[model samples]
Target: MTVQSKQGAYHTGTYRNLLLEFGYSEEEIQRRVLDNWTQIFEGGEDTRIYYESEDGLGYLEDTGNHDARTEGMSYGMMMAVQMDRQDVFDRIWGWSKKYMYMTEGENAGYFAWSCQLNGTRNANGPAPDGEEYYALALFFASHRWGDRTEEPYNYSEQARKLLHDCVHKGENNDGPPMWEPTNKLIKFVPALDFTDPSYHLPHFYELFAEWANPEDRAFWKEAAAASRAYLPTTCHPETGLAPEYSFYDGSPNHFHGFGHFFSDSYRVAANLGLEAHWYGLSDDLVQIADNIQKFFEDKDPEDYRRYTIAGEPFEEQCLHPVGLIATNAMASLAVPDSPRARAAVELFWNTPVRTGDRRYYDNCLYMFSILALSGNYRIWMPKN
Candidate 1:
């Protein structure tokens, strides 16, 4: 039997606490959320992924590479907001603005995607994925904790201005826009023509339409619609695996050897799940999530491998099995009652957060799955 839709008739700021519904006691839910958060953000010695520098800047390092990425920094900030850790959120935001924000160039208003521990820019370019996450996290921060008078601390204004630049960057002929102007789909980067399937977060765009500058609200609304329509085309009909990068028409664009279902493609399931939970905009998403879970249902997590969209495995082993499992469990938010969904969640519950050098990405996805499954990853509304 297919999973039943939980799409309520209207949007509520809150969602069903799935953990409770799944037979987890309140104490169990609270402990799991806090324990996971502590392990990720403040665990003793062997477990924590976040750290503070001598200069008081807090950053999340991709320990495997010995570098900081906007992806991790912004993701850390988002996690901080969702968990109500304002101090941690402020610390991460301060580090991002101090080190990652670009000031006078074609990419001004955008952040440098990578940096060093000493706050040095590793590259002068921006990544659209990080910028979008940064904007959404800032918006949530403004609603949850209110804004401040300082530069980067003016959360709502910072988010609004960033969204403005995302769609209007090339109007003065300085740099290309982060999104393609005509179709309103986000680019892999401002200079590219293809899209990252995981980068199309229509739920975030729906909120942007409501919170961004009035002049750009229409564009964001159109973007939400465009992305909702775009995702189904990009995913495989039978397997539901998406490429890391694809053209606007949903064909894989293999420019950088990212045409397969690899590291970046894992988030597509999670994104689609959240979109369904938040806005109830697409029923097709449930089928997509089902197809993905069913394809891997019987495979051992340790043997998970990289594959083409049609489900052909390659010699390359899966880089982050914990992360893949986490996202697969997260897809349960969209397809709650499927046997595969239950199996995925059980697997996640049994797996601990990854430790050691390559833990950053896996742990981040792990924490996100924890939040989403507990129904704590919410839309914080502004206090009037």
Candidate 2:
């Protein structure tokens, strides 16, 4: 069996293992990663974010809302796979397939965006972000652990099917495609004409180009380049804050009052950081991360709030300061020399995984930041 080597411009040897680079002992890194995962997925106290049903199904819930979201479930799957916890991955996948998948109707191959804990659908519509994560997680699972003969357990096939549907849904009159066919950009949702800036994950798209069905490989490649080029346009030239939603031309779309740097836009830095680390595409992203970190360097974390792309703070407070901090720290992976990058990492090191009603998003970003910084979040290729 041969493992695939890195194909991008970045040399693997230069990748920053931030924990080790920051003087963390190997033991300390292991302990912290495990401790964080345990608190999130296994803790018995109120801080535990995941719950398992009597029937063996498991889910990560947004405590603020009683509903289950595909975002959390797919994220749980990715985390579990990266941590080599197949049990956790399978449980979440089972719960998702049982409850969230829409097997019939316009969205047959797509998973529903939200559901009740008892396996009831809260919305039949699918979210494109969930589908993208689900596909990537499934592909990684297939590579890390050999696929089974079962339906949902057939990881590679399931991933291929999902990707096929993502790009081809409208072709068969099943539903609108998650991505715009002409531009190859991911939409906020299948029916939406605009996109979430944070949703353009070029790193994941790069891998998709290599692993997705042969017929669609070129499209995914174009998508990776399109997203890489689109990011700088969406982000502000000075502050580097991206809007939550934007048009195909990369201009902020204010149709739904989402034209500001808010909760969803926080992932832009994290995404750019990871993409740069994985593919060595740091030329433009480094400056962007620097600008973002510098913009927030003087602002107190306690006072972190929503802001216009131009850097004007909103009167409303931030909903996920921890998430913002985590992502900013993750961005440090792309911009290793920035003082603001170091400060962001230091602040994240001192902060604990959020616990309480709003901990879901914060903790998810926290875990990803932990994985990315420590060099644990990685691409798992199949051995052949």
Candidate 3:
């Protein structure tokens, strides 16, 4: 078990394989990880989300929506880099540059949040969560495979410039920044005033502080701390459920009607686990994970549903129950010693990647959870 007092993977270059700790064999873990990736990226029509374009680029489609999204694209890139699939990474990045990258608009330097299957824009605005993931995935790609002189292949430079634009978008009054300058909290979108708790990935920000443009390093550092402090506020004290959207002060923002726990909120548990695994756990963070695991320990996966932060269930069924299971399994990274944590990992290990119309999001979370538990999701730092 990982001791909370020990250094994080960032400092020590050592990661805990929780699946191994639970007595799973190394070969089984390896096979499970590979199988999950294959199912999502190369399986049959109903299974795979990735598609190779005629131009040699690739894109991951949101099968349920019949469109491609920056969310899936960025996630595919992250998975590709983590799996050491440089070909897939470059293909996805190239596709993103050609189809999603915005230019000569209020959203310049940002990727379009959604696009049709034919590469037409579905929306022109940017999602902060996608931008953050793209930046971090690019950085990891640069470290793992080294950057190239080509346009989008110059991964490090691309990541730095994107990060610069994220925090400085409105400096010349062009548009709103993704993050609020005063509070250091990332807004849900560039034009939005509120934030999504699931978008708060402090572990990524910590690395951004060290690898982002030198001028913006301090802001990234402060942003990391701010997020760590901010997360607990968004979580329900008893259930650890977070709203999909919230104000800068961490209060749920009901204006957008996404102020309840739902699909987006499912990422909160996974985020907390990954953050603790990469950067070590804190008391508050541990309690948040503990509460989440405890709340779900006895609940049937089939019964997962929309809920209030106070744990009140709605009549609506959860769209991605497997995603919820995967995230709860991931939360074990923070509270590995808890009995609830073990139950989560066991449940997740036995569950298969989701298939059908809504497979994209569920499978992505499933892959991440498996990689994380198997210690395959790692920090790809540049060799100094």
lDDT of each: 0.88, 0.87, 0.91
TM-score of each: 0.96, 0.96, 0.98
Residue-level lDDT of model 3, residues 309-328, one tens digit each, is 99999999999999999999
User: Which residue pairs show backbone clashes in model 2?
Assistant: none
Q: Is candidate 2 or candidate 3 better by lDDT?
A: 3
Two-way lDDT contest, 1 vs 3, winner: 3
Best first by TM-score, ranked: 3, 1, 2
Which is the winner by TM-score between candidate 1 and candidate 2?
1
Show where candidate 2 strays beyond 4 Å. Answer: 1-15
Candidate with maximal TM-score: 3
| TM accuracy, model 2 | 0.96
Candidate 1 vs candidate 3: the TM-score winner is 3
Candidate ranking under lDDT, highest first, comes to 3, 1, 2
Candidate 1 lDDT over 1-384, as tens digits, reads 232334621265567566677777889888999999999889965678899877776999887788889889989988999999988888888999999998889998899999988899999889998988999999999999999998889999999998998999999987889999999999998988889999999889888998999999999999988987898899999999999999999998887788989999999989876776776646576788999999989889999999999999999999999999999988888888888888888898889999888888999889988888888888877878
Candidate 3, residue 344: how far the Cα is off, in Å: 0.2
